[model samples]
Target: MPTPTRITPDSLRAAARTVLERDGRDGLTMQAVATALGVRAPSLYKHVRDRDDLVRVVVDDVSRELGDRLDVALADAGADAATAVRALAEVARRFAHEHPQGYALVFGPLPGSASPDRAALDHGAAALLEAARRLVGEEHALKAARTLTAWMHGFTSMELVGAFRLGGEVDAAWSYGLERIVAGLAADGRGRAG
Candidate 1:
């Protein structure tokens, strides 16, 4: 007789994240997660509906974590809007680098039938929106947030896939891009104010 495993949803998520970080998206399987938790593959079905459900769970967890980190980074950023934006961007980049597979799972497109956890997604977006509001004010905050997210997604996605073949110092490039975006946002805010 085998010992009963005390697997909770939280533990499942942690195991899934571990598998994701270790094997990337293609390798994140129910069997892999169960093995990580020292349980039979069938045991996971008790907690999650299917592989899609598992992915969604991990996505929500990662999204909430990203939100928490962004909030912390912003809290330490003081009143300067550019500084806040820079802080937000840096945290996002760091998170992406740290958990590339999880980053893709959270930010990448999902299947038509699989919906993400709205509150978790909103939590992260709200942090960015608040930072954008500080930078560009109320009228343009959402757009600014979208622009920043898109830029980060594009750059990070490319970097993750080793797409920057002609790169001469990727770190410098990221800094240059962030600086230009910040300057542009500041100018836009000034224009709106004046």
Candidate 2:
């Protein structure tokens, strides 16, 4: 048999991602990752705190990626805040579709009292704050950020679960609902858009 390659933090993260993609959150395990890497289980302890910590890292990593994409993908909508908002919604929705497991991991419950792994989660939240600041003005950025986060979460959750009825055009409904949000925001976004 060939010799086993060493697993570094980068390789470990890559392996963990593969596990998440293949197994979803439920199927990933410490031993499984070790086995996949051809290493003993204790060897993983050097790289990951524990299973919960590992999951947190995974969530944080994915959160950073999603947040970056959402910002970049929608920020180019120009002066039209409504246009930018719609693009933002689409980015969130598309993330759910394209990365259901990662999306779920990012939004799902933590294993226990463990907080986010610091880097990814904090940076992602900060990026979100920045996005809200861009969408609305500084005064209402916090409130608007909360509103947008909740709305995007609700819409993305509904779309991912196929919870909507089969009879209507979901895209049209989403657009209409989003328009109402933009209209409401415009009362405020209008001031900034000027």
Candidate 3:
């Protein structure tokens, strides 16, 4: 009998990501990854424990990629805190649009309490919070970060699933919303500091 093709955890995660991008959240399975890798389903177990494990790994990888993007977006904003916050939101929106399936996997359903991959998700959240803190003092950082994330996630989720039936430009709506958020934060920041 021929030896099974050797596969690393990275290779498995890559194949899983491809499956996610092509077939979406529902289509990610060991069999699918195996098929993508031209191997048997059982062969995947050598790298990942099971479907959930594969998902955890894929989500971590995706989150890490997102963190990298957020880092760049934050860095490019220079000394403007509000712009940095907006830039992070824009990056999240673009990431959702570009990787809808991957985005859904991470942001759609709530993970279990004991999930082992919280760090990856936290890393992304921390990036946002750090940027937000720079804009609105540490006391209001969490709320600011949550508000930005909620807006980005809500808009992106709706836009991705065709929830917007209006004929107007959605991108325009997105920009408008970001503008409002920045304005609100600025007002709040000034109000609290005065």
Candidate 4:
């Protein structure tokens, strides 16, 4: 295999993403990525420092993708908090549907407190928090943000892995629940009980 002469950070990240989409987290490796890019393993070192580092980059890539989608959804949602909330949920579901492995990479636990690459984590959290602030008011945004994160994350995680396989009208249930949560926020600044 021949290594391409034009190597760049963005190109490396693109290769990493391709490996992720084709192979999931477990299948990703310095060797695998190099192989995908038609380069030697050592050459990958120039782009991705180590396995952990590469994972962080890949995870950040997916997180940023989700963030961008949610950002647009929230903005398009306008003043309709219910629409905003539902849009968030739909984006999560779509993420799981389109990128289940990537979703797992973000939501799944690491073996230890490897102290996630702080920059990536902050970027991901900031995106979520910003969307929350936009959808709801500042006063209730914090709590609503927590609710939105937990609910959407859990619900979509379950949906992707078939935890909701016994489904019959699950979408309806999700919609109803989202509306009630929005109403609660609008009414008394609280999340509806699951």
Winning candidate number (lDDT):
1
Model 2 lDDT per residue over 27-139, tens place: 77898788778898898998888898778767777888887886686557665656776777778778778888888777777766446766776666664565566667777
* Residue 11 in candidate 2, Cα distance off native in Å: 2.2
| TM-score of model number 1 | 0.96
Give TM per candidate. 0.96, 0.85, 0.93, 0.82
Candidate with better TM-score, 2 vs 4: 2
Task: State the C-alpha lDDT per candidate.
Answer: 0.92, 0.76, 0.86, 0.73
Compose the digit string of candidate 4's lDDT tens values, residues 1-194: 65465667777778887888798888888888888777788997877668888887777777777777877877787776666677777777887788888888888876443235666666666645665665566766778778877887787777666687675887887787777766766555333222
In order, how many clashes per candidate? 0, 0, 0, 0
- Candidates sorted by TM-score, best first: 1, 3, 2, 4
Please tell me which model should have the higher lDDT, number 1 or number 2.
Answer: 1
Across 1-194, the per-residue lDDT of candidate 3 in tens digits comes to: 97766788777878899999999887998899999988999988877877888888888889989988998898898888888888889899989889999898888664563143778878778779988888788899999988988888999999999999978999999999999998898789878888
Model 2 clash count equals: 0
Model 3 error, position 192 (Å): 1.4
Residue-level lDDT for 44 in candidate 3? 82
**Where is model 3 poorest over a 10-residue stretch in terms of lDDT?**
108-117
> What are the C-alpha RMSDs, in order, of all predicted structures?
1.2, 2.5, 1.8, 3.7
Error of 1 at 103 (Å): 0.4
lDDT tens per residue, model 1, 1-194? 88887998789989999999999888989999999999889999999988988888888899999999999989999989999999999999999999999999888888755567899999988888998999899999999999999999999999999999995999999999999999999899989988
Pairs clashing within candidate 4: none
**TM-score attained by model 4:** 0.82
